[model samples]
Target chain A: MIEAQTLTKRYGAKTAVDSISFTVQPGKVTGFLGPNGAGKSTTMRMIMGLDNPSGGQVIVNGRPYAKHKAPLHEVGALLDAKAVHTKRSAYNHLRAMAATHGIPNSRVNEVIELTGLGAVAKKRVAGFSLGMGQRLGIAVALLGDPQTVIFDEPVNGLDPEGVQWVRHLARDLAAEGRTVFLSSHLMSEMALTADHLIVIGRGRIIADAPIQDIIDGQSKARVRVRADRPQDLLGPLAGDGVSSQVLEPELLEITGVDPRRIAETALRTGVLVYELTPLQLSLEDAYMQLTQAEVEYQSHSLSPTAPDTTQLTIPVEGRRP
Target chain B: MSAQTTTSPSPTRHAPRPSSGITFSRVLRSEWIKVTTVRSTVILIASTVLVMVGLALLGAWGYAQLAQSINDGSLPADLQAQGPGSPAVDALTTPSSGLIFGQLLIASLAVVLIASEWATGMIRSTMVAVPGRTPALLAKTVVVAAVAFLVGLLSALVSYLIAQPILGSQDLDFALTEDGVLASIINTGTFLALVAVISMSLGILLRNTAGGVVTAVGIFFVLPVIMQLLSGLADWVTDAARFLPGEAGNKMVAVTASEGALTQLQGGLVMGAWALAFLAAALIVTKKRDV
Candidate 1:
């Protein structure tokens, strides 16, 4: 288990990570969700004892990471994809890291094969593509057979197949009762792989809950009603708790009420309903709602009030709404 | 309940793995692996030896020719009367003729070893592997110093062996047991080791390969020249210039007594002081700064 209590990091006047606290328990994949420059990498570095925290502390398995006798075996982290020396071959880089922990060469070869880096293990890392670099990083992270694994933006530059491989790797590692904490800007990916999420925005924790709660709480449930006289039911549905907006002459977008109640109201009001579509909000939409104001950099054309309906291209099956 | 328990283990089970203690020997092994794996390190050590031997051969031949000219009565008697000191000078010069050049190469190699990690973003991985910064830094320092000391010692030995034949033909054989000859060799090795330590400290302070190399070269080369030029114009400046590290190191390398300078032991102490100051600064910077 990895626990961070009121952890914070500030660089000059800019606060990279605010006072945030969360625990990553074993046996599940916990996704750290944030946009670019939202302190995901900084937090991971602090946990690995790479960067000194400005305040608070992080503990891995009940002790601070630096205090661990065998840090590599206790908690392995892939904080950056290409942290290895570019001039050194992949195999040599892993060999040096493994030498630190006295981990056997067989384990290094096993991880290399496991990450599909067998072909390029002897080749210099400078020649490897970004995807291959990510594989090497994962191979190093798994070098010591660590109990707690932390990967920051693991699938940033992966192909579709590589992306699936990482997703499955994270899930399988979690299934083995290890603490799997991964960070990614890809909400759809998180929604698929993460059993729980800790969302951060502008260096502050915006939401920390189970995936289902975030989806239900932040995203509004809307029902599309199509009828001959969509305007007729607008008055009854437009009450204190109910809101209805006309999308077209025959279609009404109704919120603040479930589809069942809307359907019952339509039946009692003698409305000829042809279409009753309940819009299931994707995790992306929910994430946008939770982090709209907290986004550090806004594109010129992006409006804060605009609804987020952009399709998320996740490679996993069974998680798409 | 018994059947359920027999079917599967409890899902809430927690098994904490045993801790593996950090060993200094393991850290040393890691540092050794890290330093030897790089091609730059091998090239630098090779170049140091080659330069040392090449300069020794050149110095030996030049000295032999000079002695022959004096013996043949072609040169003035004043040159011969400079006396026994000449052979000491000749023997001392051969072993360290390439030192000025070789020291820079080895020092730059040391700088790159420490500074390039920060430049290439590899220090993050290193620090993660060894969180206690002192052990890592000490391991790196020890490794670099050991390699440097070996290179310096081997180079001096090779230079002495190569010069032996030429000096023999000139009727002036250098006894390895001579106080000046042995002092020069041992002092050269110590000086080279000192230079490597200073370079490693500079590397940690700057954390940029180019900056560290430039600063090291500037201190060893540029500063002494500037101090010399200034001393020639003023008497007080000449007195102050004696305390500079390069000047002190030059005095430390001399096989015979020189006019107006600190004793060899004092010069060594001055060099040691410089190394200690640089090391202290580096340790503080490294300990306080983020990787």
Candidate 2:
């Protein structure tokens, strides 16, 4: 188990990670989600003892990381893929790291074959591709076989097959009662792999719960309608926490109201409703809703004439349980 | 990328034994592996030995020509008047003469060994394995310093053997049992080990390969030349310059002490002090700051 208490990090005048506290439990995969520059990498670095915290502390397996007898065996982390020497072979890099803990050479070869780096284990890391580099990073993380494993952006450059492999590996590790903590920008991948989640925004925890609870809490009834007059159909459906976006002259996407309510309103108002469709809230949409206000580098769409692009400007007020 | 790669064995199979952990000896072993696994380190070490011995041979040949000119009465009037010392006594320094270039290469090698870890982003992996930070840094320093000491000792030993024949050609040969002769050969290694310590400390403080190399070169090479140019301005300048690391280390390997100059023991102590000061500052800073 990994526990952090009021962990804070500041660089000069700017705060990279605010005073945040959370716990990662064993026997499940906990996903760390945040927007760009939201302190995901910095948090991981502090946990690995690479970056000193400005305040408070983080503990792994009942003690601080450095206080452990064998830190590599206590916790293994892949904070960055480029952490190995470019000129050294992948096999040699693992050997050198393993030597610090008196780990034998046979185990080093085992990781090499396990990561499928046997074909190029003897080759220098300078020649490895992006996918191959991720494999090497994973190989290093699995070298000591610690009870807790942390990976930051593990599938950033992986292919589809590589991505699936990482997903399964995370699940398998968690199933064996190990604490698996991972971070990724791919929401779909996270949805498939993570059992629980700790979402951060602007260095603060926005949500911490089971993955299904997060999805359920951030979504409400959303309905899409095509009618002769969208404004007329939306006129009576404006209150009760309801909102609508005009997609076209005859189409409207409404939130906070169900399709049956819209159909009853159209029938009572004497408006012709051609189609009424209710959309299920996907993890991507829920994530956007949760982090819309916390995004640091929001990109403004340049194509202002696009009809569907108008919804991007709407404010999403988070409704939490 | 293969499907079978994901089918890793259980964590229990790879769990370390209860007795295995981070020890000073284990850290030292890890550092040794790191130094030898890289190609640049091996190449630099071999070249240091070769260049040191090769330069000593050239020094021996130059001294032989000088002794011949004095015997043939073909030496210039200024050269005859300013003989500095007998050519026989001057030839005693031939075994360590290569130190002129030896120090440069050794200093660069020491800086490269530590700074390259930061340059290639390998320090993160290193620190992750040994998070206390002190053991890993000290282990690397010990390995590099020990390698520098052996290179210096072996280079001087080989130069002494090969330069003996050339010195004998001019009747300027000296025995290893001569006063201060064997001490000079041994002190050559001691001086280089100190140089490596100081240079590696610079690498840790700067944490940039080019910056560390430049600063090391300035301390060992350029600083002495700058001191020489200012010596005529005041006697204090000349006195203070003697305490500089490069100047003090040169005295540590001198065949004979010049009048009013630092003795071999005093020179070694001064350079050792400088190395310790830099290393202490580096350790304190590394402990407090982020990697």
Candidate 3:
């Protein structure tokens, strides 16, 4: 398990990671969610004891990473792919790390095989393609059989097949009762792979909950109502805690009310409802809303193109505004 | 893709942790592996050894010719007055001459071993593996210093032993048994080791290859030259310049200290001060700063 308490990192007057606190529990994959320069990488570096926090501290297992007698056994982190010396072969790179811990060569070769790097393990890392370099990073992370595995943007340069492999690998690592924490700027990537999420924006914790809770709490649940007499149903659906939008001539999108209530209203009012489907909120939508106000580097358009959906999440209740 | 190839192995692939995690020996072993694993680094190291030995052999040949001139009484009056057979004696010290040029290559080797890690972003992995930080830095220093010193010592021995015949032609035998000669040869190796240590400290402090190389070259080569150009203009210039790392190293490894030069012990102390200062700075910066 990794626990960061009130960690802060500042460069001059600009704060990179400003007093953020979170805990990554064991036996589950906790996805670190943030946009670029949102302190995700800085937080991970601090957790690994690579970067010293300007304030507060991060600890792996029960102690700070450097304080552990066997740090690699406690936590293994891949902060960046292609962090190997270009002059050395991948095999030597892993071997050197193993030597520090008196870890055996058999395990080095095992991680190499596990990460699909056996084919090019002997080649110099300078010649590796991006995907191959990423695989080597994963191999290094797995070399110690560490209890907590942290990967920062592991699939940044992977192919579709390789991406699929990483997604499963993280889940499998967690299934073996390890604390697995991964970070990605791509919300969709975390949505598919993460069991729980810790979202940060502008170096602060924006949201922390289970994946399902984040999707439900940050975004309103919309219901798709299709009926032969949809206009008649719209009148009955107009009430407190209920809002409707006309998606089509025969279809209405209703929010802030359950489908059962809509179905009962249609029956009591004699509206001929053909279909009632509850719309599921994708994690992507939830993330966009959660971080829309906190995005640090934003592209400002001089004029409108299409509706700027990524920039502004549509508010469900205009009554308060 | 090759996971199937491991099917015949033991069912469990989990690694058993060693009892001691950060033993100095293990860190040293890891450092040795890192310093020797690169092909270019290996080639450069081998080249340094060959150059050390090769230059001594060439200097021996050149000194043999110079011995004949001194014996024929063709040398200048003032040159002869400095010391009747100083050229021949200095000629027997061909290994120190080789060290002048050889230190550059070996010092550069030390710089690249550490600074290039930052250039290629490999320092991240290195720092991650050994977050205690000093062990890795000190381990790297020990490995490079040991290799450079041993190579230098072997070259000095071969050079001194082989130069006997050439210097004997002029009846000038600066024997290894002579007072302070053996110590000079040993100091020749120690000076080279100091060069490596100082270069590595510069590399770690700068964390940039070009910058570290420039600073090392300036300290070893340029500073002494600048001191010489200003020598006659100021009394303190010559004396102060004698404490620079290169000049101090020269005095420390000479058969005897020259006129107006520091004694061997004083010279060694000065250079040691330099090496220790650099090392302390590197350790402090490494520990206090973010990787």
Candidate 4:
């Protein structure tokens, strides 16, 4: 298992990872989700002991990574695909790493064939394609057969088959009761592959729960309600935690509060309710909404006409939980 | 200590064995693999030897020609090429003379040994495998120093043997048993190895290919020339110049001591001190900064 307690990393005035705590349990895949620059890489680096945490600590198998005499055996991490020297052949690179742990060359060749790098194992990594590089990185991570494996953007630049292979690999690793934590910005992929999710935004944990619960919580029984008097009903219907938005002159979309409550509120306030349609959001929509307020490098498109663009004029209210 | 293994019905298909501890000797082995596996390392090492021996041959040839002219009584009557010392030994020293330039090439190998890891982003893998950062670096030092020393030794032996016959024909007094002759040849190798260690320290401390190479060159090549020029202007400059790492190392190969200069042992100590200081700085940087 991998556990991080109030782990933090700050560079000058900018905080890459804020004090955040979470646990990655074995027997399931935990997808670490974040927008770009959401501290995913920094957190992974700290976990690998490649970077010192500004505060708190992340432990793999109940100890800091460096404390383990054979860290590669305790935990395997593929933080970056470019970690291998470009000039070294993939076979030689793996052998060199294996040598440190007294691992034999035969195991190195096994991982090579397992990762399907046999054909190019002798070729220098400088010539490998992006997918091939990812394969090599995966090979390195699997070399020691650690109880916990962490990969950062493993599927980035992978082909469709390669992506499916990684998904299966992660599930298989977890199925064997290994703690598997992998990061990705692709929500659809996470939806398909992850059993649990730890979502981060602006260096803080936005959500950490089972995948279904997060989707349910974010897309919580949203219903479209049509009323003749939105302004009159807006205040009376706006109970604690209930978010209601007027879609048109006679249209209202409501979430957080159930449909029955919205109907009763409209009836009690003498606001005529015409239509109510419940809305279910996909994981993509859920993630976008969850991180809407938290993205650090929020892109402001020149096409202001695009609907659903977040407001640039006013400060976003307290971020949604 | 081994990681706590919880048997929770792991479905993992890959077979995993108990992890062996990371001993310094294994780290040395790993580092040796890292050094020898790369094509650049092999090429650079070969080049270092070639340059050293190649230049020695040229230097020996030049000396042989002058000696020949003296033997033939061709030069001015007052000019003497091989007066007393073994002209053969002098010729044997010619090939190693190229080591003056060959040291840079060897130093380049050392610089790339550490710096290229940073440049190519391999340090992450290397550090993760051996998290005791100091051991990881020291391992590299041991392997590179051995390789450099071997190259230095090979170059000295080849140049001395090849130039031996040429100088012997001229009736120059030169033999391995001669006082200081064998020591000079061995010291030449030691000097080359020390250059590599110092260059590697610079590579780790600087962590940039061009920066490390340039700094090593400045210290070993440029600084000595600058010191020589400054010596004429001040006596203290001479003292300081002799103490400089490159100049001090030069004394290690000197057959005869110049008055008011450090002995070979003192020179070796000074060069060793420079390597250690740079290594300590590299370690400090490794500890203070994120990889």
User: For residues B226-264, could you state the per-residue lDDT of candidate 1 as single tens digits?
Assistant: 888887688988887777777677666666767678767
Give all candidates' CA lDDT scores: 0.81, 0.87, 0.84, 0.83
Tens-digit per-residue lDDT, A138-253, candidate 4: 89988787888999999988999999999888877777788899999999889878888999999999999988888777677777777788788778767777876665688766
Question: DockQ, in order, for the candidates?
Answer: 0.41, 0.49, 0.42, 0.48
lDDT of 1 by residue, A107-169 (tens): 889999999999999998889899999999999888878889999999988999999999889
What C-alpha lDDT, on a 0 to 100 scale, does residue B15 get in candidate 2? 53
The CAPRI category of model 1 is acceptable
Candidate achieving the largest lDDT: 2
Model 2 agreement with the true structure over B147-249: per-residue lDDT tens digits: 9888988999899999999989989888999988888898888889999999999999999888988999999999999999999999999999999999999
**Highest-TM-score candidate:** 2
Model 2 bad stretches (over 4 Å):
A227-239, A263-272, A305-321, B1-16
Q: Is candidate 2 or candidate 4 better by DockQ?
A: 2
Clashing pairs in 2: none
Candidate 4 CAPRI category? acceptable
Give the worst 10-residue stretch by lDDT in candidate 3 chain A: A312-321
lDDT of 3 by residue, A151-255 (tens): 999998999999999998987777767788999999878877888899999999999998888888854667878888887877877888778877678877888
